[model samples]
Target: MVLEEAYVDNQHNNLENVAHEMDGLLQFNTDRMIFFRNGMQSALETPLDFMILRKAEQEYISKRHEAIWSVALHNRRTLPVYGVSDAFIDKDPTLSRDNTLSGNELMATLELGYLLRLTNNNRGFTERMLYVSRSGFFVSTESANKHHPGAGAL
Candidate 1:
């Protein structure tokens, strides 16, 4: 079935896809077949099907982040990348940069799921792919875990 609404079950809290990936799963039932038009390369190799689950749901912590990572090596053969860590932090909240917040604290209007690993490069273990379904803005929220001892631990 082509459902544009959120499909909820005891197993899942959010079943509605929040992003329209240039391509994403839409349908694949009985015959279990689905095809989508792509420019040149195909992102989906195997067919995916939804499940009618009835498992119990429990407390789970959710987290997402949108930040750019830049590293510069001394002649491409050094560590720490010399002061790159400073650049990794979000300085301008006016830039509407939301970095360190638990999922519940996040005012995200969309949900993004990613694999545990994306690729490997230059000591970079695994990256992630984020698909923002709708346009949204972020205002960085201060984390209390840094100030108080276990005030708000995720």
Candidate 2:
């Protein structure tokens, strides 16, 4: 099912219908799978040096992006959700020019995903492919967790 709107809300206090909707969106059960599949490549291609910066961005988004939307839950509470863009540029600033190359062509995206051991439920979080400009960066609403199901990495 497709989500008409996407927003994180406090789960515990939320009604059953609202909770069901949130689960669907977070689980990524929509037809937007193609966007996510492509987005994985884009996120992986992000430079290694910038990984820390990217992680910082992810961390920031997890903690503060939707401060008002989340609430405590029973088992843990609410899981973090990240929405990364489809394209990104080298944040080195020293690169001088932009690295707008496709991650598929360069294999940077795949490589990074492997190195980070990221999965759809882990490393780089996204719901759809975003068209990121040169300086564009991701703004996640959740944090990466150690709770991801361990089947594969990257």
Candidate 3:
């Protein structure tokens, strides 16, 4: 089912609080699925469906970009953050001029790059896919967990 307006409203109101809570989850190396689920559970009195929870998680990730950047920045021993947009600049001539790009487009592009860098690069990993049904957006965590052990497990 599509997310209720109240739920989305509540999440938006609690964005910063949720982002801070997510830091603790990150410390424990919690899987993204579990982190999102728990984050929603903590934020709202009502339990949301998995699809709604996933959307909430995406929202949280987008809102928490600065927090994510801070963590990555402080951890100097971690993998070097690659210049993902730099590659695109060379490939797409239109993207070569910084003045032509809007602020929103640059931020969105950088966020996409950050997400790609945040994700595991292992060859055999099965990435999560969104399945749209008559019911709504469904991602089968059971199958995902089967492919990647302890993936959806809390």
Which regions in candidate 3 have their CA more than 4 angstroms from the true location?
1-95, 98-102, 121-154
Which of candidates 2 and 3 reaches a greater lDDT?
Answer: 3
Model 2 per-residue lDDT tens digits across residues 1-154:
1342333333444677887889888767553455545655665564334454355334433533331221111122122222222221233442222234422222333233332233334433454222212323221222333223331120
Of 1 and 3, which scores higher on lDDT?
Answer: 3
Per-residue lDDT tens digits of candidate 1, residues 60-94?
11112322211211221111100111223345332
Residue pairs with clashing backbones, model 3: none
* Candidates sorted on lDDT, descending: 3, 2, 1
How do the residues 1-154 of candidate 3 rate in per-residue lDDT, one tens digit apiece?
3569888878887997888888976765556656445544543443224453344334433433231111122221122121222334446554342433323333333233233333334332246422221211122212334433443331
Note the Cα lDDT for every prediction shown. 0.22, 0.34, 0.36
TM-score list, all predictions: 0.16, 0.19, 0.20
Error of 2 at 133 (Å): 3.6
**Which residue runs does candidate 2 get wrong by more than 4 Å?**
1-14, 29-130, 135-154
Worst 10 residues of 1 by lDDT: 52-61
lDDT of 3 at 4: 90
Native-referenced Cα lDDT, model 3: 0.36
